[model samples]
Target chain A: MSGSRLSRRTFQRLAAGTALAAPFVRGAHAAGKISIGFWDHWVPGANKATTDLCNEWAAKEKVEVQIDYITSQGNKNRLTIAAEAQARAGHDIMAMPSWEPHDKAKLMEPLDDLMEPLIKANGAVNPTVEYLGKADGHWLVVPATAGSQIKGPCSRIDLLKEHAGVDIQALYPAGSPPKADAWTMDAYLKAAQACHKAGFPFGVGVGGTPDSVDTAGAIFSAFGAVLVDAKGNITVKSDTVRQALDYYKQLMAVLPPDVPAWDDASNNKWLISGKGAAIMNPPSAWAVAKRDAPKIAEQLWTHGAPIGPKGRFAPFVPYFWGVWNFGRNKSAAKSLLLHLSQASAAEKMVAASGGYDLPAFEKLTLFKTWVEEGPPKGTLYHYPNPYNHQVLSMAGAPAPPKIAVQIYTQAIMTKMAVRHFQGEAMEKTLAWAASELEGFMRT
Target chain B: MADIAVSRAGTVNGAGGRTSLHRLMQRKSTVAFLMALPLITVIVLLVVYPAIYSLHLATLNKSMERFVGFGNFTFLFGRETFWLVVKQSCIFAITAVVFKALIGFVVAHFVHNIPSKGQRKWRGMLLVPWVIPPAMSTLAWLWLFDPSYSAFNWILALFGIDPVPWTGDAYWARFSVILVNIWIGAPFFMIMYLAALKSVPEQLYEAAAIDGATWWQRIWYVTLPMMRNIIAITTLFSLIVTFANFDIVRVLTAGGPLDHTHVFATWAFRVGIEGGDIPLGASVSLFMVPILAVAAWFILRDITKRGNEA
Candidate 1:
């Protein structure tokens, strides 16, 4: 044997000793390590912007950071959140979809300290964010800019003007506050009817999907319809709800007959196929159209939702960055979140998302990305609610979250409308909704 | 040689009480069990443990903080949607399995009678549906049933027919989902019955022919009697799978049009995963076990009976 070679037993002993000491060695260096799971962005290069921002922060802070772009597709992000919360392990930070921060509030680290400073720097946070991201007066997560989106009327500008005689650009003009007083539910129904007669119907779905529920929620909110109040009382039997249902019945008649079966992608597909005058959606449809069919993309305009008896309401789904209480490097996680929430980083994220992402802070809403993105210039100018023309609301809000989540996920509002549209008696539909709301309250 | 003989004699004679376990381990049955240890360990860890954990989960309340002991079950029992799901799950499983078995039997007979040289190509083509992942194929089906751009509707429109609501109406949505399941599953039954067909003795058919039996009679008397076990087992398997189906319904309808098409699996997913009520989801899923267990019991008992008869 060579003099440099060790005996087999000695070699095995040394390997075993090293293996035994490895975790301790890792523990010694773990103080500066932070891992975060972000919602995988739909827009190309959006994830890279967030990654670059994180890398910049990590470099300045001398911390090692790992980032995971978790997709919300197939509920994988929610599944990851549930698994991490159950195991008390996984990433130090995770991007929580709307209602998820409330769902897992107990396991999340209260970020009042991180959020308060950001709130101070970037004006007041959106009330909808405060409603969903806070539990018992403590902020459980920082409102995220990566996946946050406002679902509004993304219309075919040419089709609306030519067929429906409603010019979207004139109503919500670029570089100015919306001249939207004439944009009411009655006008929306008239436009829908006109568009339907023109064979390019409005593609609004009343199915039990998130898009369907969100659209229904906004309409219901606009009519001041509350299925369950904040204090957990069932309110489905009110006149407001009945009025909302009646409006939906008229609206559904103008929609394609197959809308009841539509999934989340159905509306997007409907718009991109050039068969629909408008769809209630994020900029995803417009973005997809931009890539696949530029002609259709150039005509697309995202503007404010129509007004109702109470007010104009837009469906807002805000993603949040939550720190798990059991995370190893919480200090680093909080610092990284604060850094990302800053105006400069948030603006970069919104720009990268092609003006699709909406920051939760009021001050950050004026970023030029919304005004600048277009094939037809200023096509997305009204996307981020820069003029605050509409009330930003989530479906199933005002109810206690535990009940509201059921209301949202069960798609009660849409289902009730569908039941009524399918020729069920109005009273019968209201009773069914009342029963469902009761069940939600009971559970 | 003498020591070996002595050891063997001692094992057979139960000569040492301390070595009883050692002797037991040397037996053929014990050796077979040891050979199966890895698989048993795997099943115990993966299948049995998760099932038991899910059962435990079913008893807990929504938050899983308190043991509610059947509270989730009671809650599900009271909800109208839950009852609808139960009815829908049964209808989906039974109806899909029946059609799948019937179609598979007819197709298998055709394949069996075809020229042996061409059978391979036909079988491969038939098996394509089974081979492709259901998720990928279902996405294609989703496109084919797209509300605005359905290929099927386009074809119908060519013949002056109004576009059919393939997945919009509650009845049509149920039909669409069941049709997709049968399309994916019939191939599996075809291959199984094809194997069973090959094993049926040709002489038995000849014997029936000599007795002047018709083609239908031959099949009814000889072929069915022989393939009964395989049919029972395949139907049982398809029943279990169809009852617990999630992908087709989830991808197609997502239990929409007012929860008209929700099966147990999809409804459970909606309530449990999406709704963030894991305990209730577990309870919903646990309801599947009794129906599946009853099916398995009847099918297995018949198989066992036929085994004993043989």
Candidate 2:
């Protein structure tokens, strides 16, 4: 009892010793722990692949890894990022969507040293990835292997052939360069009209979501219609802009009247319900149909984006792996990110996603998963653009990040189309857009 | 002898009695303040602090670094969408609240007319919409409003009515959002009104009947006059909630059909959070304060007047 009831001096000495040894205690367990905020994958087994990869790396490095797969539904991922930024603490790494890496550059740890070796081994990253992941000569994020999808047209082969009289296989054959340069904006309009008349409309949205913005951006880019140019100039009143608007007006006439209210899920639902002949999206819709409606899934073919007047451009939404600057395990986070970016891991992710995942690296684009997936094998072979047939772009690109983010988030291009379709004068619509852009620039 | 006693007592007790009395008053005041400290702390921490912080946030630029007084507000004023959002918010809140009041009154009267034993069942059934979480119910509404496979359209098709765009056209989208708000909010109003109706003395209605007053007249004279306070309080509560509504509009239209159906909360979210302009978003949210304060002031004044009368 006397020994247990230590003197105050002895107690103080013991406390001092513990305090002195605390750093070493922490160092002993410095195998470290990391928490990652991952994007919730839509593909069936894609999340497992990511988890298994992380687990493999963790075992090898003797680090503890925590993964939280956050959903993009209702903009929850963005909300999580904002909440973490405001609180100055959260997951050590996060899977940032297309515009976020640039948006949160200051809060992120630079991954240049980790990415440089990966890039050298894997060839150059896609230019779109570089445009987003790098800002001010620093790599803000390492391009992620999962959930990086290219929102191109996924056409029902039977519906396209029977209604629109277009041969999907010939236009964009599997394991070959897409012969789709002749599939112009004019052809797209005619085909949409044909399909709509045949009671199968093209599923596209003009809502304030990524799916709508991406489609509208690709369409506008095809006509070389830059509302806000790269230099942050307002070009809404230009001739090309007028041409794009006019073309969109015609296309809108042939589309469903309810296109203005659709979200990212709407197009997927439209296609899976077998009411839409094609949708501008990645293969997730078809992947869902593969489970829910196998008959519809068998007929779906993922292919090249239709050519516009300017060129072919597909909307690519890439997820980037970013480490928080405030993270405790910076070394572990970077190392894990590098491990995930490897070609072996990328292939596993692509297979797990049923080719829904697109790797940003130039050499990793031709993963065998694309060649082997499906009821009709090789349906998604051309989804990944190994050749330079279509330019990989996004809604807010080519404009300065700040202004472009405004334009993209405001859903300006889609709104303009809706206004014109709803019987607004073209000149007035342009004026309204110009004024909105001016306001955004001012802010 | 009495004068001598009084003079002796006055000399003994004058300073000490006065000091004791003063200390007693001070002690009572201190006890009351200490008793209210928890509530004061809660208000200062939860409500007042956040309100002030949001005001501070509103004055900063997009990056939250530079102090740009009124810059965000000025930018919002210049925006055409901002004006549209203002108009839409006003229309949404006013239309939804009015309809909810009318519908709730009618439904409550219907429920009150039923037998007492059956009333509980009907009340429970009517309150199903209110009891369900808004997000879950909104998802059901979203599915029912789908352009292609809407259940409503399926029923309409059987009647040879062309599929009406429930959430597609701008006007219809506005109508849909308001309709959902009314549906979700009317039950609360109904229950409150029902309670007020029960509280009304049956003798008044009998007295009205004796005067040969019609059903409508009795409601207007006896029922309405008696329930005015409850009506005012419920309407004010619904107004505040409906104005700041986000889930219904966010899930249903997402300010779509060219942002035609956007309300204040959804637009603020789109601007501040999604658009990556926290300061501007904060400024947009702060716009709700004046309207809310005015409504609160009117309600509080009404309650105080009622209290004085009682």
Best by DockQ: 1
State every prediction's TM-score relative to the real structure: 0.93, 0.90
Model 2's i-RMS, to one decimal, reads 1.5
Q: lDDT for model 1, on a 0 to 1 scale?
A: 0.91
DockQ score, prediction 2: 0.57
DockQ scores of the candidates: 0.59, 0.57
Compute the lDDT of residue A369 as modeled in candidate 2.
Answer: 87
lDDT of 1 by residue, A48-81 (tens): 9999999899887778889899998999999999
Number of clashing residue pairs, candidate 1: 0
- Candidate number achieving the greatest TM-score relative to the actual structure: 1
Off by more than 4 A, model 1: A1-31, B1-31
- Please provide, for model 2 over B237-307, each residue's C-alpha lDDT reduced to its tens digit, 9 standing for 90 to 100: 99999999999999888888788898889999998888888888889888887988898899879877987
Against the hidden true structure, what lDDT does model 2 obtain? 0.88
**C-alpha lDDT values of all predictions:** 0.91, 0.88
Model 2 residue A192 distance off true place after TM-score fit, in angstroms: 1.7
Deviation in angstroms for A236 in model 2?
Answer: 1.5
TM-score of chain B of each: 0.91, 0.85
- Interface C-alpha root-mean-square deviation, candidates in order: 1.4, 1.5
